[model samples]
Target: MVFIRATQSSSDIACIAVAPLSIQPFGVEPTDFDAFWTQQKQTLAQIPINPRLTLLNTLPSGAKVFLLELDNIDNRKVYAYLSVPAGTGPFPAVISLPAFGDAPVQPEPLIMTDFAERCNSINLYISAHNAPPNLPDPNAYKPDDLSKKDGFYARTMIMAGIRAIDYLSTRPDFNGSLGVSGMSQGGGWTIQLAGLDKRISAAMPINPAFCEQDGWRFERASGFPNYVLVGRNLNVDSNKTLTNMRYYDAVHFMKRYRGALMFQVGYEDDVTPAATQLAAYNKYRGNSTLLTMRERGHTYPFDEYFLGRYAFFEQHLIGFKNPFNFKAKFLADAGNDRTVKDTAVLEPQFLVNNEKNKVSNIQWAKIEGTGNVGFQTENGKTVARFSQKGKYLLRVSADFDYKLADPSVASYYTLTDFVTLDVGESSNIDVCDSDKEAPNFSNCPQNIALTTMGTSALANWTPPTVADNCGTPSVSSNFLPSQSFPIGATKVIYRATDSKQNTAECSFSVIVTKGDSSTPPSKNDLAISLTSVVTTPRPHSFTTFKVKINNKSARTFTDIKIQIPFPSGIVTGGAATSTLGEWKEWCSNNDQCFTWLIPQLLKNDEAIL
Candidate 1:
């Protein structure tokens, strides 16, 4: 549940009730799921696996890097960068998938080098869709008619992964063990590929997308490719869309996957909600582990998360002991099952129980709100008091003294708690107008006093200043003072602003009557004239024009607006360059016009445009 309240100050305050993770099945395996995939693999097999390899400059003197391509189900081609160790009869392999969107999937020479020399494994980083391996082109591939089962891009992309595995099998240095890993859309593909292929030995999917298709129906976050279920992308045939999507849903795929699975989830991820990820994870009937990052939204800390993956794969693929075993606990007075008042005192604590590692450092952060509460460790207890009202995520991160076996051994753990603080009614403000009188052509009241109630309320005017036939007038303060006005009436508005940026306003009109000979004129006494510089002006041809404006009034004027219209078919070139004013172009009804705002024009003053 979420509640939003509009205040008299800044933006509305929001409080969200974090939902508990539970498996609510919304996907049903298609009746022809196995049959469809069986036919897909057969179709891919018929197309000769015309594998093409282009060797690039080898790095580190111990590995060879090559660009690999293979034909998939469609006429499209799949590309990847394959790095193989120097001396190897048959080496273990891992297939890295690309993320969603138009991000380039270039070969990472450093990453491939580490995988080949350090891990003693062949690494193949594959690109999804018909995307080129070296550069990203947003218009490379457009999804087909999603209403039909065979028209979707997921079908072809999934086939590409299957065909990649087939190409890896043909490698002279390929070992029997295989693994898949990716994040977001790539994560979804990893799980789907593992489920479809029984040869997969291990899988790690980080914040995977394209799961729980029906999540939007319950107001929960849906994965990428969720567009097919709502808005303009929604299929005309809802029933067929639902059935076809289930065939590609990750939850259905996880149910059949038997490989060792490790999943990473971010609790604050609106892209693929933790609930949806949990739904898929709970459905898996295999050996699996989940790493939850409480405050992360749509992404994970790459260094720590990848270290854990390296340890997992090292143990399973290389037959290593995986010595990295770090554990941490973060606790707060505000538990998951309860909500405290806005002014409640929060007591946070961090504990680490690792005999092999010592706690090196600790840090805390308030993810939301305008409170001045700062974390402090007093007597071995981490505590802070929150005084503001809003939603906040309190996070505590701890680093261990011991490092992992990978490039960086310093292992870290982070924990977070969601909190909401509700305060009383917001600050408010009120404003009133001041009455005044002034002789024609003479200055009126310059300032007015305002009556306001609330915290940090300020007075101001909407227009700030006004102009009439008599002269331009402005207020000195929040209260409107007597100012020069024309014979007619002029409206003056006064406003009040509160600390929270809330505003209230009131307006009054000033009327000026005819006066003696000493009184000023009631209208702006100015003359403007325009002339074409060219003697013969032709249609659709460019021509220069000269404009002159002069002020003949007794009083000075500022911020004067001058407008000039041009005939159609005569486009403007270059700039109208003004001698003493700012020029701006205006258009209406196929006609072009130019306006100049003269900053100041004293009596008998002239400006050229």
Candidate 2:
């Protein structure tokens, strides 16, 4: 539903339209990175406690699943199913854990299989040993199995995953990058192992269960069952347990750990809750990405979502490129122009250049309205995640209606500005208004005037100190070498607003050039490489060998001229050269063959003879 809020008096009326979620969506623009992150932290402060869950799963390749048992450092045997892939060499591996269930019923064998195929890594599953293990000590698997204080399950299992990596290192085929993943309770442990174990290069935890647990009373029957079981065994107070669990919580642990992580969440899910998942996410300051489902439940869009997750781990963790790294394009709403609403979509390429020395992630926010908003991959197809509040287009489209009613009648309201994701500090852009018309500057002055006064290679320039009615004016420059100006983009785009609130833009380029009169070469370690070629008759007059000097005083420089001094016959002149390009000179050789003439030079000017 959309409405327009208008201020009207007899002769004139102004309208600002209100649109539903379908036409306008809310999100932080890239300029809001700091604010958004700050908000996330503030939210975390409100909910201080964390939750818990226990998970178990099968690791496999049907060829032959074996009950492989291993002992931890404490010598307690831990049971696991090891599934070796069909490859010849040592394969990369991932230890899989399933969401909490009392029994290892329908073990998520398929996901483990996918792990092998997708990641080309070995899969090891540590089953949730619900029943008591046949042990010498009755306390091992009892109702209050506090065998080793806070129990050995956490440390032992994490070590088991590390051991798998060690075992992988033994095989000649292993590449040595370990990735860990799990969902629900599994997600919690995956986080734990990833943080505590330095071996894990990548980790993905989906719909995790260990964050902000003040509300989820899992001690009750219908609550998250895995939390209940863990609470019962560990004698933990589920409500106040999170504060003590901080040492064990993956979220807190990540602060001390650094590496790659991928988090997934369901916006509509109350189970692990998107906000709580984000709480864990916000705690992580390392390299990571989040994939969230807006209208989905706790049961994620596993096939497509997990497939993407595996692909991400394979590329970043395993250093593998996708076979279908193709290009596709789509259009999105930039708002309306004429009868057609202006739109913008990602350029039709699935991949952009991987930024040098920077971490980047691509995300699409849902936009509501008649025209649809979503991300458009390089492939021409559109993926729409259903929404009850409004319609969404994964990317901008061409078929959107251009005709808008009255002075302003928008179908949706934009809550947050679109983030401009770019490299470095240049990622900030302006908040655009849909109803406003673009400034008309097709006939403005095209000439650009730029000048520099310092010895520094015109590194960069701040926009001209200028302002307009809107307050201060701002602009950006695209710098290039002098030779590349204009064509190479030595231009600046200036944006200004008038007293009447009218905006105008102008562009100009500087005609840059190299400085005149090259600075002479210096005489550093300038020993005679070879002797002089003096024509007989005009014997090079060995006159006053005073060091020729210049007036360029920028920085102090030492110059030495080692000359093959000649007294009489075969006259020769010593030339000056420099390893550090600076001012220098050539003078007559004096007395001895090794008589060295050296002089210190300053910046900008040079010496000669």
TM-score list, all predictions: 0.52, 0.40
* lDDT string, candidate 1, 1-609, tens digits: 233444322244333434222345566678898998889888999998899999975767578888888998768888888888778648888888877776775566446456766667888888775766787757554665567778777888789899989998888778778888898988999989988998888898999987887666566656776844643454357666766777778888887887777778766666777677767876664444456665566787765566666776774564322334533222222233234443345444433331322333344445445544434342223555445544455533334332333434222332223344443322221111111222112133343222111111122233442322111233333334333344445556554443333343446654433333354334467888887767696755666778888877654444578777766656764666676758877734434777788755555668888
Task: Give the winner by lDDT.
Answer: 1
| Candidate 2, run of 10 with poorest lDDT | 410-419
What is candidate 1's TM-score against the reference?
A: 0.52
lDDT of 2 by residue, 1-609 (tens): 111222221133222211111221111123443353345334433432221213333234333344455444344444555555556645666777767654433333455555554445666676534221111233323333223223435544455555545555666666677777788877877876666557777787877765543223423112132334456666766543433333344545444446666666665454665555555655553444455454455766644345555565665556333333321111122222211122343332222123221112223443224322323231233332221222232322121111112223221111111222211121122222121433334433454432222222222233333333122333333443232232122555666554345666666655433333244433541212332233343544543333334434333333344444445564444554432233323234333354334343334445433
- The true-versus-predicted C-alpha distance at residue 260 of model 2, in Å, is 2.6
Off by over 4 Å in 1: 1-21, 138-141, 229-231, 319-609
> Scored by CA lDDT, what does every candidate get?
0.62, 0.43
